[model samples]
Target: MPHDWKEIQAGDEEVFKKVFDSYYQPLCLYANKILNDIDLAQDLVSECFINFWEKRTSIEIRTSFKNYLLLSVRNISLMHLRKSGEKLGNSQFVIQELEYVEDYVNELEEEKQIVRVHQAINKLPEQRRKILQLAVYNNLSYKEIATFLGISVNTVKTQMGRAYRFLKEELKDDQLTLFLLFGSNFE
Candidate 1:
């Protein structure tokens, strides 16, 4: 056993490798129970390990390694689910619903719908695109975006309104337009 948790705390790669190798699969399995998507579960587990290593110096472990790893996985998975607007439930049922949704999108019309939506967004002015990206991708509030860009809250709201109008006009298809509107709002 690597007795010097201090060395691990200092970001020794070997210790991290040992810990990662030991915990990765079990953590993924644990996270999958909450996230229901295998890829997302794996991603959450990886993020948890990276976070653990990053904050290792201040980490105090009173529990066994398995318990600590599981707790970390659970927390990360829950965060991901919350962000994605999913609620935790039976893992199998959640996974089935996810797969069905993915398959539904894989149908022919959905591909064109996605492309049209992206094209409409691409057609937006650079400033509007930046504002939308900040608000949607980074989950920033209107006030935060205004502060970051040195603009007023009203300006941010106006830009978002303009962006939505452009998207609504460009994406004539109802599905695509609905997606652009709903997907733009993180909360």
Candidate 2:
């Protein structure tokens, strides 16, 4: 029988438990397919369930819970990949090996690097910082940034170039320090 998540949200713990039990393994397996790490996949699935439980009151079941869980796993996996700087490969063998370990420590280190990068950006002059933020964080093209900032495209490009140069100089030492501190073995 198909479980209606709406009913599960209506104060039915058993129904919710039944739904979770039914989909837990499958969701973890699906996440493993994307993340290539069994432990991370399991963690992602567990977090999904935690989120589901916390937000149960506002749950909407347009599709099956299975589909919902699968999508959540995929998104979480992608976020992990992005944060870890992992390359996407087409080799099944390599992917299988990725399932062996969950490098939470490395992920945390990468997060710290991201914070350092953010701080470095903040140290720039206000206009230069805005240009850099628009170009990098917002993924805006130089022309778009110029239009938004009411500046010439050439001026935007020049400012962005200077910003990158300054960032490179400022972060060079930190990058080496991070490499040493983090053991230089990241993806």
Candidate 3:
């Protein structure tokens, strides 16, 4: 009910506290769905609010304040996942637009597939695991990972290829297909 963002923009601490109290728990819960770690989710949501307060004067909210806060938390959660080397397979971290009731079921199924793929990635050899994590989780390009790890671009590419091949062999057919289809784009 506290929608007077004007006061918040004007450095009213009480109004900002009210807004935070209203949205913080719900935002944390929503972030937890994607992050799967309540502690990390709470931390990310806290960071989102901190950034929101810092940017209040310059930021414009075109939608409901709740929506803006939720979107902010979602983006921050995804950034945390990227930094932590976690990849949510298929859909590429997009918030899906559900067209039917069955889409919800499909979404759950996809989440399971993503978890399986992540497990398979964890089982990869150490070098390939690191390379694939950089590519998939960190969103690093081959050249960037090469530079970061002090390896050649060709080495990065070659390791990534072997990583995928190993993953294909390790996972079952359906899961491997899902990984192949939704996994990061390879060169």
Instruction: Give the best candidate by TM-score.
Output: 3
lDDT of 2 by residue, 98-152 (tens): 3332233235446767788778778999999998778766878889999999999
Span of ten consecutive residues with least summed lDDT in model 3: 97-106
* Sequence-dependent TM-score of model 3: 0.48
TM-score of each: 0.44, 0.44, 0.48
Model 3 lDDT tens row, 2-88: 245888999999989978886677677777777789998899889998999999999988876666776787778778878888886
Residue ranges of candidate 1 with Cα displaced over 4 Å:
1-4, 90-187
- Leading candidate by lDDT: 3
Residue pairs with colliding backbones in model 3 are: none
lDDT of 2 at 108: 41
Error of 3 at 77 (Å): 0.7
Tell me how many residue pairs clash in candidate 3: 0
For model 1, residues 1-187, the per-residue Cα lDDT tens digits are 2353556878788977976785576566656656668898888888888888888888888864545666677667767777888766666664554344334434433565666777877899998999987987788999999999999999999999888777776754464346654673522
